[model samples]
Target chain A: MLSVAEIINLLNSIPVGYKSPEDNCFNAANQMYIPEYKKLGVITVANELQDNLPEADENDLFCDVPGCQIAFENSASYQAHFYNVHRYLCSVCRRCLPTAHLLCLHILECHDSYFIIRAKRGDAMYSCFLGECKVKLPTPKQRREHCINKHKFPANYRFEQLCGKPYKRHTKKPSKSVEANEIVDDMDVVADIPNMK
Target chain B: MEVDPDEPKTSPSTSRSPTQHIRDRNRQVAQQHREEQRAKTIDTVRFGLGEVQEEVEELDELSEQDINGLITRITRRKHASAEEMHKLSEAFLQSMDNIKLFFEAPGALQVIVKEIIGLDSGCQVGALECLCNLSLGEAPVCEKIIHQGGRNLVQCLDSPDERLKRTSLWIIANTISTSPKAAQTVVQMNIVPKLFYIYLDDSGEKNIANEFREDAAVCLQILVMGKNRAARQEDITFIKDNMIKKCRNSVAAEYHLKIIFHADIVNPRNEFNIEQTHHLMDFILGNLYTTPDFGSIANRLRIVYAIRVLSNMVQCVPTTTIDAMRQQLRGVWETHLEVLLNKVFDFGEDLLSLEVVYLIRNLIHDKSPQPLPCQLDRLEVPNIDYEKLLPQEWK
Candidate 1:
């Protein structure tokens, strides 16, 4: 990730003058603070360096599916795998790929169930962001709208669709492992109920 | 015209006096006697007939210099004086005869012909006239013109006066008619842009009859039809907005429609791309039947031709890009297909009519789930509703 000073140096390299130094500084800061830099490059570096972390050797690679040994070539390849295997979407058209920018825009602008869709499409199984709805929406838009409209927590809701997931500010969000077991139990009950009927 | 009386009158010898007939007979007998002797002494007199013929043939093979010399003499004496002008006019007329003579003997004056022809403004017209003549025949002059700074002729296109512009274009059109390479050269020089500029700036200024405007438009119409990609994108844009729109909207003449269709065929939009030509064709196909009034017969025919050329060109383009475009323009195709069909058949035996059929046939035939045309199985029906076409789902 680029530092604020490095970003400032980049901005200074440009020939045009900004209205004020404060505005330039803020813009430069915002540009450097992308989720890709934080999650993919910076945080991993920090975690690995802090204690010579045990998981440092495993950090360089990711397999398409859990327990599968085939290594993904890059982030884009991993993203493509999620799309091709799980969602069956067109990459260029942004059919069902979650991280695809154009598709995300389409979901946010056009769809009504953006929040539930987003959480369901994430790597982990989780409870609904809204207090009332338990339905798994496919995208971030559904999750966001559900939190704002259903929960009515305007101030606490953070709807940064690019990187940040919609989370309730006051709640202790359950980890993926716990949520996964809960999801399995719920699926079992639904399956059992269907048989009983 | 003055008739010279110094020449012999045309009549039978029998009408003349017997004395005159006797003298003519005696002269013929004496000429025969001399010919018989000359024929008998073949070894002495005719020793080099074959060699002389060969040498003459060789000289005839290289007579371009002689022609240039004749032309130079005329140009040097500028014909500033009335007597000189008359003499020069006489030489010019004689040069016409000389042109006929030298042109027949191959290679006579072939080398410096372009330079000689291009020598002066006065001589350029004559040179152009000769070029036009050479083009009309199967003379190798067109090849020479192309290689010998032929595109330099386009410098004449800059005339501010409408008549000169019209004439230069006419000359270019004539010169290019017999030479595809010449036509290609004209296109490479960006003649379309210059002609478009002239058409827009001069068309309505003088209240010239639609006849004159049509003539000017015809020049532009041909230049656009030439499909010159060497033309700058900015010129293409200007032509699309100003010249094309003006032609479509103008009440002065239907000939302007030819200009619009031709311009559309070449650039389609101001922006340059391979698809720009296809888009223009698609636009015309859409507009031809959709417009409330289809304009005149010539204009309609031109529009049909544009469609045909566009469709032919489309077949050569990559399937993937066309498919993407088809998906993008599904609405355009659906709404306009019927209208295009109604008028597409008007072009008979022309490729443009066939192109229209292909466009319509492909549109109706392509049956992809996605709105675009693809290499996959053809669609029997395309579902195009503008409202439902927007992105409906996201994940």
Candidate 2:
């Protein structure tokens, strides 16, 4: 279980979203627990929200990131170097997230509407967790087939249904109120949970 | 009608007869009629002059009243409706004197600019048109418009209404055309990118009319083509960085290349760095190699622009840069030169042939160590029919 101080710290770091900070932390943790949501893919978000990556100079082709002494003669090589050497990308939204923890935070803050709509539909969501593959299937059989045929995942790879019930249960809560008393109530509930991670 | 003294001697042969008496009486009657006719003509002239003088005085008073009314209407705190503003703009367009009077009014430009920013799109279009006419006045008037509301005019370039955008571009074009100082003032406002975006509206939707694009292109050309060195440099840099760099491969490449060519004519010596020179060489060479459909006038024009840009690059770009580019693009250059020579000798487009000839001349004059792809000495000059090439009036 998270200590009170740790929960308070997590609450302070929640970024732009409609949910309370505690709820955001809870949702981010839940998203992190799902394996398929951790895979990175092409960015499909707004350019404004994309990681502020520096562009390679047309002639010089040098990385402008601080403390990096890397350079290349061509743009393609420079792009490849940057892609491989730096930055973690959010798998669900394909946004570049700086760290694993921020990726978790981004998932909950940015994809709240997606999760809510899915939970409202009460449908099972299956996605390929393999390298940069964003294929989502409706059933375990199709997912397993996709993983085996497309990604070359071993047949014995265990496929679990990604989170559907947790979002559905949370959907019933009244999300409009962010009163202090309600947050304390949330804190109490969070404290009661045995496995915080 | 008066009897001459010599008439009596000529008539001495004829005795004082009844015929002479009748002639004298008849002549006196004719003289009396003539006097009456002259008196009538004088009276008519005096009457017409009086009417014309009165009408002129009335017209002067009416025009003065009309100008004052227009100035008052424009300077009002409350914005004029679209119809009223349109009528006022039309009235101002009738004469430069009215435009002068309207602008000379206290706070008239400020009020019009306010209406442009604060009114509905329809009204804003009218106000913009009014400003467009106002900018068509003397240089001082254009300077006043730029000093008063240049930023608002630039903002109107982004208006959703096509007329509003076009009128804004027209105003800017007029302002820049008046004097270099006015053009520099407008350039300092950072309007190049806005005008360029309007020119190259890449959005698949045809929201921007061709006329608006033409006006925007004119404004951009004037801004870059001005003799003001600082303003031209600012505008050229904006076009190179924001427009040309972003849309080098798009369909608008021809237009961007034309702007660069025009800007290059007034370019300061050795302003382009080595990298920029190389980039330009590659771009110009690439366009030169790309064959266009000769049947399409638009495509032919694109080639003309490309060749002209290549000529500018040859002339203005540093010698070392040119040498390096020549070495790197030798094969492409050879093909391009062959195509240009063929166009000159065979295609018979007077303008295109002339530009190619100029490009060849520039190449020869550069005098690099490497030999030109084609032999100028062996090449036969095509006999161009000057009469056929001349314009109809010239012919």
Clash pairs of candidate 2? none
DockQ for all candidate structures vs. native: 0.00, 0.01
lDDT of 1 by residue, B105-158 (tens): 433323223332131222333343333333333224444444343443444444
Q: Backbone clashes per model, in order?
A: 29, 0
Tell me the RMSD of model 2 versus the true structure. 34.4
Which CAPRI level is candidate 2?
incorrect
Worst 10 residues of 1 chain B by lDDT: B41-50
lDDT of 2 by residue, B1-395 (tens): 88787455435524657777567545544654454334323321111111333323322222757768766875664556655555555445455676677767888777777677542334455567667756657789888887777756765665554555666777777777776777776665556666777777755533223256656766766666523443455556666665434344544455555566556531435356555665666666665556544455445545655665565565555365456565646644654355555554455555455445555555654343356654454443444443343224323
Interface RMSD of 2: 39.3
